[model samples]
Target: MWISRAGWSVLNMLQLIFTLAWTAGLIGVAFVVLLVTRQRRLPLRMAARCWVPGLLWGSGAKLVVRGVDRVDWTRPHVVVANHQSMMDICVLFRAIPVPLQFLLKQELSRLPLVGAYAKAMGMIFVERSSAREATKRMREAAQLVKAGATLCVFPEGTRSHDGEVLPFKSGAFQIALDSGADVVPVAIEGSGKVLSLGGLFRVRPGTITVTIGAPLRTVEIADRQLLAAQARESVVALKREAA
Candidate 1:
């Protein structure tokens, strides 16, 4: 079950360094974007492109996605998925070829270069510990959707220690309600085993599947609890399918 921990650590460190360089590269791109257009979507396509090799070669993680065709890429949508590890973000970043706005924790905005990159990438950050702050962030996410941006939410709120699906947070569903955005349930498998919560600087070289489920309509759910339940059910079904 254990991959080469020492070798993985070295590779992981290299990824971290590369991410720093990538961040710097993005800053340059952002500057160019400002000079080129009024749109703030400069990091959309490039981020996804840069993310490919960053996870594939940087960590030896290959990706396989299913149900991607089920989605209407031309229209805007919200993506809901499980959070198993930090590697999950990198995997999704690469596999998703579209412009994505991530709903991330506010603390992540504190990271030096990564934070800057996240901002440039149009990530929506929330203060999880504060209900008010979290609400404001959700509203901001809604606005992003209104502006024709696709958002990704890890409804589990945090990474699960065991592979079992945890309770879905209502915030993601709530945003769907406010934004009138379709929810695309995504299931990410094998990432948890690759880089567990046990420690950082860990990786397992193998295929990681990011399966997108059929879009769930927000208006169909009458309540928050129901919305959360449906989101969880979608993720559970996705996991089973991935299994």
Candidate 2:
């Protein structure tokens, strides 16, 4: 939160420019690929490939991942992580090379250009205010996973302002249990410094690590609540290891 005005301005300009350029290029590539193969997974793969430069453009920020092989890409996986900043999504997008569909907020689906792209990417948006609608959306997310689509969910539900992990929602873990997909705990470190939640334009460029943990099969767990707690603990442990 204590960034110099000059540094904040420069960071903001760079983020804006990179976002526009990346979006344009990725969308163009997606259009061409859709025309050729018409395969849904191709666009997601292309998006991941396209995000590498933007992730690197964040000045000094870098990712040091651990337990990368623990991730089983052979089937759908539920990647759960703590929320810290908007940059966390970008970092994970570039770091994890899987065809992922984010369990995003419904409000994000209303954003101008980004929303359109997010929707096209098969991102599941839940209406947080409506419990019934939220449950329905979670069910849809489970169905997506059953369809062999990897789902990424920020269990904290929102970015934490204090750079500390918050309480996680059980929806994601529950979906994994119901869908029989493996739950992968991911810890994203130092992203809060890159873009703090409380700060407006104040940004600090630094390394951000994303450590992936071993996959936990939800079917082995009889209770969903226990599974969620265990998944949360795994992420916290990974964060500590990264620290």
The lDDT for every candidate, in the order shown, is 0.79, 0.80
Model 2, range 1-243, lDDT digits (tens) per residue? Answer: 587778678778777677667777777777677668867688877766666555556445666667778776787898898888888777777767777789999999998667877877788999999999999999999999998888999989888888778877877787898788888989999988876666454456688889999887887885777887888899889999899
Residue 227 lDDT, candidate 2, scale 0-100: 81
What's the residue-level lDDT of 163 in candidate 2? 72
lDDT of 1 by residue, 1-243 (tens): 554757667767877687567667766776577558856565566666764565567656677888888888787788889988887887777766577879999999999777876786678999988989888989999988877888898888889988788999786777888888888888999888767677655556677898888988877875878888888898899999988
RMSD of each: 2.4, 2.4
Q: Per-residue error at 73 for model 1, in Å?
A: 1.8
Q: Each candidate's TM vs. the true structure?
A: 0.89, 0.90
Query: Any residue pairs clashing in model 2, and if so which?
Result: none
- Where does candidate 1 stray beyond 4 Å? 1-19, 22-31
TM-score of 1: 0.89
Q: Which stretches of candidate 2 lie over 4 Å from their true place?
A: 1-4
Candidate 1, poorest ten consecutive residues by summed lDDT? 50-59
Number of backbone collisions per candidate: 0, 0
